[model samples]
Target: MNKIHYLMNREVNYTLSKCFLTRLTGWEEVPLVKTDACGLVLFRFNNDFTGLRFKLVLNDIEILTAAHIHLGMRGENGQVVAFLFGPVTRGISVNRGVVTGIIVESDLTGPLQGMSLLELARKMEIGNSYVNAHTENHPNGEIRGQIKRF
Candidate 1:
């Protein structure tokens, strides 16, 4: 039997530590960091048995995708927020059928589109968020996730 886990009433955040190229049906991690860079933020909303994620890019721009999603974005003020929503599935399907009912927001804007995270990784000199702009860059960062058991 499929154990029905209820994510229908929770909201969580996943901090993406690495850039990735995603398909409509699966995920592929991308190595987009060579030096220090700020990671993006993923806001997930569980609604009526569906999983939704959200994020923001430069200029307060936003983007949305399904749970089985992939994205690479430009960090804003040191972070990006992406919005996504759809059925939540675990494991993997050897072959996924055609994708349907993908819910994209009306206000959705392409922030990472045509942008290269790899290039950003090369040009940006990651440094302390709390440090002065003239300080030396630190080529290191971290991401953390916390979950609460109901």
Candidate 2:
């Protein structure tokens, strides 16, 4: 019983230590546009590696439309794997706020369809993923950042 408890505690600590962070800015976007918008994303994997909890904070953004995690390298575009924010009405905007959610296997789509959360976490570990924030002014992506483990 003591051995089992120790193993469980170790797993919990390991999960808590698996964190990724990214800073979003327009300059990171392809065909970069000038904008005052910026944001940050934090991703943490669950104990069982079956879910990803994320928090995205945006500032000075306008007419916000959506945010997503994409499977791609820096300076490249990729298909969306998970939606972080609204595909809401185009007129909606945010000056400053936070959007938090958990992404599971079912949330995986596009090229990530049927993939496990562990697969996505592995992608992030290797710098093959990015977070993109979309706005009315830049539907493609107003701000972008490469996800990195930290």
Number of the top-ranking candidate, with TM-score as the measure? 2
The per-residue C-alpha lDDT of model 1 at residue 6 equals 26
What is the per-residue lDDT of model 1 for residues 2-91, given as tens digits with 9 covering 90 to 100?
Answer: 333323212211222222211111011121223221223233333321333334121111121222222223232222222232322321
Question: Which runs in model 2 stand beyond 4 Å of their true positions?
Answer: 1-17
Go through the candidates in order and give each one's C-alpha lDDT: 0.23, 0.88
Relative to the true structure, candidate 2 reaches a TM of 0.87
How far off is residue 114 in model 2, in Å? 0.6
lDDT, residue 108, model 1: 26
How high is the lDDT of residue 134 in model 2?
Answer: 91
Give the worst 10-residue stretch by lDDT in candidate 1.
Answer: 127-136
Q: Please list the residue runs of candidate 1 whose C-alpha ends up more than 4 Å from where it truly belongs after superposition.
A: 1-32, 57-68, 71-150
Local lDDT at 83 for model 2: 94
